[model samples]
Target: MQRANEALQTQVTELTHGKTDHQGSDRHTTTTVVNFQPFSQEIAEEEIPEHVKTLALDSYSGSSDPKEHLVYFNTRMVIAGVNDAVKCKLLPSTFRKSAMTWFTTLPPGSNADFTEFSTRFLSHFSTSRSVQATITAFLTVIQRENESIKSYMTRFNELSVYLEDSVPSVCVAAFKNGLREGRLNGNLKRHQETSMVEIRARARSYILEEEDNRQKQKRDGTTSLKGATHLGPASKFNQAKTNRPGPYQARLSTRPSAPKPLKVVNAAEASKETGTAGMNATCGGTMLNAPVSDILKEATCL
Candidate 1:
């Protein structure tokens, strides 16, 4: 029994070390491949993430065959921490019965493997390579008049992916050249070509700076408009008037009120004259002297 056990252990070790089937031309070598970190991210839960559904749905293009967009949608799955098993299982639930019937018709034994399924899917639908188209798009990327840096960068990155053999420096230069003429673009032009990392850092800085400027402008505009409604040409006219005083008002405000002359009074003389003459006639005949203000008031009244 011990000798039999020893023989079994020897056979096991030989098999583990890949025993040669024959010598020379007929010698066979078995390859043992190690699968290290198969999953991109740790997927602790059994159920797939809900974002996977959204991603698949969003990426699934109706115009193209299912095979044409599988790669595109698969990228999102990889990023979402899904393994091949989970991806295979969860992907079908996203499709309708009519659409899924195509997958049902796949060759026998092909349904078990993800790689096989992908190959079959792509083979069923002809997807021509887009290297030339991608190149054209990359070369023609340009920043629009008021396009955001993020949007421009996103477009640039997407296009750059097509230039598979392009150097990082060349890609960065292409991106810089596509930017609109402004502070950020000028900085990129004057900047020394270092690396894609540094270029992206500068781009991020410019984006933040632009965002701050936009927010400030929005706040200022809101504050000014909050004071009154924007009345087109009339608003401009009102604003100009409010900003500067009217010519007539300014002229009148500077000039002082005109003074009126006081009436000449002779009370003592009138009294002496009245003492000799008949008192009633003298007093009644003389006119009473009035103050300038009172005279002006009387004139105004008249």
Candidate 2:
């Protein structure tokens, strides 16, 4: 009976691979009609919102290998709709007992926290993200150049919790160092007293403050430029002609002159660096200045 079952499984595997090959050929034949996308495996715990990531991972749970699922999950989180912030509302009722209980316990309408979810999911389903590995990754985390301050803070807050044995000060230092330096860093650095709470608060406000200041500066500049007189296209010309001179001095001043031409002297002289004088009148599109001829002659002799 065992041998028969083994044989049946082998036959089934061969049929599956064969079917996949047939489907691949059909897809190639109808490229215009078919749009295919591969399933993802592992996800970056930091990247996607808590809810959507859960769904992606859950969908792949039935695959043959958890390791492949983990990799595909990572690819999905890093890519997918993470930047768009398209979050899903996960159904706790649909989840297995362990995850379902964790979800049900959260405050009403609250999404599962990414840290909590990752811990529960990885511990129960997959060993790809071991505790030590997660902690190490968290410790070495740095803010990506394209990542927003809010996203960076969110990820930092989630990861820092795993460092239960480490002091807050150490984690705070790591978080501070991880943030890309800007007005946010400057404001936080100004306050002598340090804490994650203080940093988080300031960071939240910093982006808004920077944006407002930028808008104000832009408005002021536009107004000033509009009010100012333009004698001609170039502002320097207006300044040079006026400069406390009489009002009529600007009128009397000639229009600003065009830039002086650069003297090439000779085309041959210019083309010397290029080895071939470019399409000369005498050369008739042939190479001038004996270009490559010496090398060719040397090769011929050899």
Candidate 3:
């Protein structure tokens, strides 16, 4: 038994190496024969061998075809190794025909159909290469039926619910928010630049006006000192005329000996007389003498 097992192991290794070599050669060839297989067939659950059935039931409960589901599950296992989260939830008994029913009803280019398909099957699978290979196989079948690539892509988009439902929602929200913020920032930047430009233009205009006024004043000989000197000349001419007495004023000054200079009653004398008249008129008594400043200071203090 041990020798037979060893022989089987060696044969398996050799077969694996041969398959790899064939695949490499096929990659370089222009035309290579490829196999086409359909995934629609159902395997009888009762006919499944006990050990394999136990394993399949544990992992492929939601799939319609246990055999095909096993292939997809194994491929995912190989691709994701032990790090995949969704793999832990798979069970053989999870298989339900309704899970894949949406695929049959989907029109050629409907996103809803593809979305349903992806949600039912593709999302459960972990291996990108396997998923791609499966998609390519489906595309080959579709092309064989003379469908356009556009129709295929439309179906593909419809089926790829993972990208459409989750990734784009999160990514597009963040992207749109970032774009909105950037636009607002750009608008603020433009407004600031415009305000600065207006301020600089206004400042330039004010400086130019000031410079023009200075230049005109200089050209007209009306600069500060020149204007002051011109005003002084007019004042000097008026002073000379005022210093000479008028012809009629000389005759009137000689008469009446100037009447003792008429003891001019200034603002202080007038204020004192008015205050005394008010006190006499109000109290009917002549209030005794007090200096106007003293009276004003006493009244203010009171």
Clashes of each: 0, 11, 18
Give per-residue CA lDDT, model 1, range 1-302, as digits (tens): 99999999999988866644343223222221122222223221345657665653543322355554786668767778777767766655555544465554544334554676566555543322334455566678987756777778888876565343345666777787788777777888787865656777887887787666655545444323211222123345545656776899899899889998765545455657657444332333343464555545545444
Q: Write candidate 3's Cα lDDT for 74-100 as tens digits.
A: 565455443222332332235445433
- Model 2, residue 287: distance off in Å is 74
Off by over 4 Å in 2: 1-131, 143-148, 161-167, 190-195, 214-302
Off-target runs (Cα >4 Å) in candidate 3 are 1-50, 56-72, 75-93, 103-120, 123-161, 164-174, 178-302
Worst 10 residues of 2 by lDDT: 36-45
Cα lDDT, model 3, residue 163: 35
lDDT, model 3: 0.40
**What C-alpha lDDT do the candidate models reach, one value each?**
0.58, 0.52, 0.40
Tens digits of per-residue lDDT, candidate 2, 263-298, equal 533446646656764536334332334447643654
**TM-score of predicted model 3?**
0.18
